[model samples]
Target: MLPGHADFALPAPAAPVRLNGRRPIPEVPQMNGHSEAPSANEVPPANEAPQPTRSEKPAEPIDVWDQRVAGALAFLRRRLAGNYEVDDFGFDPELTDALFHPMLRVLYRDWFRTEVFGVEHVPVDGGALIVGNHSGTLALDALMLSTAIRDQTRAERHLRLLGADLVFRMPFVSELARKSGATVACNPDAERLMSQGELVGVFPEGFKGIGKPFADRYKLQRFGRGGFVSAALRTGTPIVPVAIVGAEEIYPILADIKPLARLLGVPYFPITPTFPWLGPLGLVPLPSKWLMRFCPPIPTAHLTEHADDPMVVYNLADQVRETIQATLLELLEKRPDPFGL
Candidate 1:
């Protein structure tokens, strides 16, 4: 202090110490407009609170394989413990939900962009018959309908499909179909399923509906012998007529190859625009907009032995067909285009 000058003689200020290992802030001196080097002794007020800086964190990625593995393990555990549920017809509920349904949902919800209407019309409890238009060269309509019932309804009903003889004729496919809740199409099976208070799904149009040329799309084919109607009546189950649109366009059958079909020993060899020409790629379905509407339940409790009468069954079947046909026409009018709607 004495070395500088007599005017500079004064006690020096105490040095500031760091807090929480942080260096003390410095105040710069003014030179020109900007301040010069700051003093190291400039400390903040002790009474003030320190503010924390805001930081954003990136989201962690999801491991799809992990989820799939975990789900598989869980499914395995359920099966080993005899916790899995399957009907008398070998309809493995656990297997269908845990495995097959996920793959089919990709087609139902994502590819087709399916929209379900009048899901409320399907009974949540007791036995009921679901009759819908069947089409699409691959019978994808049935799968889509099954998905709708499984996903939309509160009860999450499993649709017991009545498959044709050809469906069970395939080796591995027959086993797969049975596990997916499908049984042979017959009066005895339908009656038995309904008696157990199960929801039965029937495609009355049979091969005609699915194998028919795309030009006949949305046209109601003849309901076979009203046998499904008789089944519903026998079990005193209500009939739920469902109208399906957009299945016809998935694979447009331009023509039928009679010679090839006869050789194949199949119902009909469909000549769709892309099939056989595109090879395996032709099997891919067009992402057509799908619309499924469920009409109100037509109660059969009022009708007596009338269900046994051929004429009564015919009239009832016609009524159901007409109703579905009218509804389909209305729905078509509402839809502007097949792909977009």
Candidate 2:
């Protein structure tokens, strides 16, 4: 009270630390299961701080479409790596019913109205070589045959198409051919696929078949050196003569390879015989319809295992060629319109 101002008392003593909000720190035991309490002046080591858990990981955003696409890719990888049988290689009858039948219903139900004959020739199960005339300019024939096989036989066998070098030589086209199960027309590849109980389809004429002059339409071209025969004999696969009508008239070539075609490095130049240089409107197939028939299967089972005999291979090739040629002639004579609709 004797001090300067009695009313101005000293500051109240500082409040003690309130530890109520503080957590009870966990006791991290030492190697001996006992820990030394830290002193006021002690400092922790560099790595002594608590580490983050997996729950602390940042979230990665994913779009629904991307996730779906990834799932599909994983499924496909598994399918391709699994023991893929002919029926399981996306060629299953059920898969055909699901995807192909719908497409056919759209493309051919009432509009295309296809009629097939001699489809019974395709065996229930075994290797077979299908030799057919190729036209439609763009291999619509191949696609059509695939569709027919699925629909008629209820067999989901893929045709191992033997395409020309030009097929693999093209940029984007090569991938499309491969997706369609085409491979290079080499004996080794053909024989290997056939040996695996696969059906091998070949257009021996290659580009020569598709681009032949209108004057030579419907005429059988020379069979290539019996290479296919050698493969068939080696694998004991039967040969099925196939004749396709209505394809030749799809795009009738009037003119042949010009300088531009040579520049493009294609075998023969083509000008579809039509008006206005066959303007976009005229490119449609003439609605001639399509007829495909698989003739009787030519069995190689009787041929000796020593089918390496050149004469035997050649004779078999000639027989296949003749059978296909005769069938084509018969079909052409019998059909009223090319498509047989």
Candidate 3:
């Protein structure tokens, strides 16, 4: 004890308070010096606004159209700045995705009402040769086929097409073709693309298939010398046979003007129902329901040694031709009316 508080004594402790035979809860002091606590079920005063629960909070709005516009503008800026990549074959994937594919998607989806089947047969990775029947007079089937592959497959693989020499000879068309992943149709290019694990697309039927009259619509023309088969074999790439229906009906060729075709240095001068009669307006393709089916891939890995064997190449080419023909017939049966929904 200190000298000043020597006489001070500790106060006696208060007895414990109980209510309802249990320890009493201490009251909470309020700002007004009141020791009463609010009840658990008490409601706020009428003057006070109710607080919003977590679920009742407003969410920030998102404008999808605005976002798309902004994205397109940015893509344009990048393109103008030359800030994009192009492969050795002159394939500009960015341009293909942003420009070419979007434009073709409109034709592929709304105009043609294209449907794809057996897309799973296309490998996610590695080289493959896709041989398809060519028609539609303008090679529109190739564009549609490329669009279908991108849309249906899980990986959205780009198909490197083999274009004719005439296609590469044109001024504006050549640039577009190269940018869209097309190279000159030759064994060296085909083998190179496949060996590098690119999905290469080829129309072995060539001009014979696309230039045929509507009378011979679905009848496939001769697949050239099986050069595509030899290329696939050399690269040890799988060959995927594809059948395309409805392209023939799009620009039904009534006749071929041989003299005019010769004069213009073109393979054929097609005389469609509306072509010369309708003038520029006739260039528009008719709305035809398109069906594309990819057949099971024929493995060439085991036949690499027989790449130069003419007999082996012939048999494989025949098999692919037969598969495509059978699939085309099946698709035709399914779509009885070319323009049917």
Candidate 4:
């Protein structure tokens, strides 16, 4: 007898039961010459199979951590074997999707609590220029914007950013920039990318927009030379004006150290509330509620011949700048508090 069954005992048969070739079935009690079913309180016969109790549990689920580890190993193996491909512009889509985007998503989705709108205006395929306001001292808005488009869009298109020459001047930074699909901000590069049906992003305000004093936040800076407009016109690509809020509050520049900036051969050296005083800890961006809006695309296909026209370029650039400014104000109204949940 089993240990748990010590208190239980099976009743012995009164008469010898015979089964020549078939299994023996439990005999039911007879009442008035008719067979009666067992009562609810009655115990089943020893020959019957036991039913499962309510305490029994289902099988355990697979470990997601194990799957992630296995996937990471496979990715590493592929990278080690040189099995990945990069485009002519040194853009590695696989690396960008697998590695870079996932890391940025934590900041984009959770830390900043970003909200995106007007993704429908982004074309599923073909060329388009995304023009956005620049801020957040460190250019983190650019990364967030790229991540946003990829996450929100149906096709998950990559935004080819046009970075300042200073970014490519550094060694490791240049390689990472190229792999992440960023080139120098130039008309030739922009035109080529758009011609290839790639979505190119440009910040016309340059360092001036991001390095502006905190008091001047959300104010539109002068778009340099309207070069982005000319590029769009030359490629006949529509320009999608985007406005980003909350980035202004992340690293508000209280002052600028021009001497330090010149010494480092960089743009304005910002002095934020925490930065340089808090040292390395100051690098962490504040948890601000972010709002991004992509306005309707301004078609430039009809202005292809006017790509070289200064007036046409200036007007288009001004139009895009105004659209972004208006959208920023609207988004600001929607998000009353910069740090509100």
Query: Each candidate's lDDT (Cα)?
Result: 0.79, 0.65, 0.84, 0.83
* Best first by lDDT, ranked: 3, 4, 1, 2
TM-score attained by model 3: 0.81
In model 3, the Cα lDDT at residue 173 comes to 97
Where in model 3 is the C-alpha error above 4 Å?
1-66
TM-score of each: 0.78, 0.67, 0.81, 0.81
Model 2, poorest ten-residue lDDT window? Answer: 16-25
Give lDDT tens digits, candidate 1, residues 116-233: 6677789999999999888988889998889888876769899999999999999988999899999999999999999899999999999989988877888988998999998888
Which numbered prediction scores highest in lDDT against the true structure? 3
Q: After superposition on all CA atoms, what RMSD does each candidate show versus the true structure?
A: 25.9, 33.3, 27.3, 23.7
Q: lDDT for model 1, on a 0 to 1 scale?
A: 0.79
What is residue 12's positional error in candidate 4, in angstroms?
87
- Residue 122 of model 4, lDDT score: 85
User: Candidate 2: where are CA atoms >4 Å away?
Assistant: 1-112, 279-283, 304-307
List runs of model 1 lying over 4 Å from the truth: 1-68, 77-83
